[model samples]
Target: MRANLCSLTFLLALTLQITYTTSKHLAERPSFLNPCDYNGANFDKCFADNFQLLFSHWHDGVPGLKSLGSLDPLSIKRIKIQQDSGATLNIVAELENMLAYNASKAIVKKATLDKSNFEVDATLELPALYAEGNYKVKGTVLGLNINGAGKCNLEAARIRLNFHLATKLRDEGDLTFSDIVSLKAKILEIGDFHIDVQNLFGGQRDLEATANDLFNQNWRELFGILSPTLEQTLELVLKDRFTKIYAYVPATYFISNMPRASEFYG
Candidate 1:
């Protein structure tokens, strides 16, 4: 009798263990459908709308900018701009001074959007771009410190970004819904960031003359070397803004409809 009782107790415990494990596993399973499917919501419009709404909030800096972290006073310990063979100049630069770039307005000139691709032609009016830095040059160029500050402007800047829809289940209390898993935005064109820096050599005639020769005579060389840093700075600014937006907005908000899939996928 005791043996039969022990056997029955073991069987009951095993049954409970199996039931608990299965239930937990099922509960953890995601409930949303793949976002890229034909049956899923119209992601093209979703992306377009989000982008438009995003621009509206750009005046104050990307929505939720504070949460992402500071993009201001971007640090550039040192950056080198190289030239191609037979190029007139090569330069190494440093921003000992901090840069303050404030965009007063942002307008999307044009945009192409779909489930798989995205692109935009936009302009950001940076009413203020203060520069405090120095540039040292080598290779067919004047070697000296260029120190100054002035107005910076970026006009008709074009950006091309492509990404696919990703979905994940977000649990809030007793409710759960799909959310954007992750995304990446690539800047095809950093556009033109021109700095009208003064005092190339603190009014030193010889150095200033060489600087003029390098810049005026070999403008392409100067642009080639300087453009990368400008591009990277712009990229960081844009990425931070988008990241903040992504955190507050749900994936479904960008889509026209949500379709349920038997299996969950990105």
Candidate 2:
């Protein structure tokens, strides 16, 4: 009887151990914020929450342009978004351009109505975006024609923007764009027109070097002359993006228990 009791106790302990190990593994697996297990009912909510979390980081990273004194950086005038098979977002905001300290102070890059332009419409192929469990945003400024009072007709200017975010442990996706693109502009009549090739290169290098500098500086306020209409194409693979799919679809197995006869002798 003593031996039999001991054997039963050992079997019970083994069973408990197996259960604990399996449960722990399941818990550790990576899961989607809103799993697509139940159709796409929760897709929208999941997308919004994930996007905000991702964009917040980007918004915070970009230091406020101080060329416009005491102006709010987060004040975006117009925003438009459209999601078909993919998603497209268009945003319009005032941007300030700063000048070097040695430059003229009278030429403060003050904010002007002519300096405030809109992002031109552009189409982005969303399907090309394949970073599941990730968010990717790309933008480009085209046809930047500077037409205003002082130093107008700064023709043939261009700007480009690219953004990417991933929640997965590893960054896996094809998120690269072609190096070469085009820009076109028409020179308009305005203030003195002077082309300073050296100043242009110097200004760009300075901005890159002092990317975080913002306190006391004079900069030119340039409006977003135009932006291409936004077009986006995106592709998502839910299972591959989240590792939790492996746990939910575990391998099939059969469990069987055979009866054993035991006798207690006096």
lDDT of each candidate versus the true structure? 0.38, 0.19
lDDT of 1 at 74: 39
TM-score of each: 0.49, 0.17
lDDT of 2 by residue, 1-266 (tens): 00111110000000011111233122221232322211244433433343232123322221221111111112212222221111121222221231111101111111111101211112111111110111121221121211111110121122222222221111112111111112222222122211211211223556422321221121111121112211111111111111232222221100012111111010
User: What residue runs in model 2 are displaced by over 4 Å at the alpha carbon?
Assistant: 1-40, 62-266
Write candidate 1's Cα lDDT for 51-162 as tens digits.
5555443444333233433334433333334443232333333333343433333334333333232223333333234444544433444343355322222222332333
Backbone atom clashes (below 3 Å) for every candidate: 0, 27
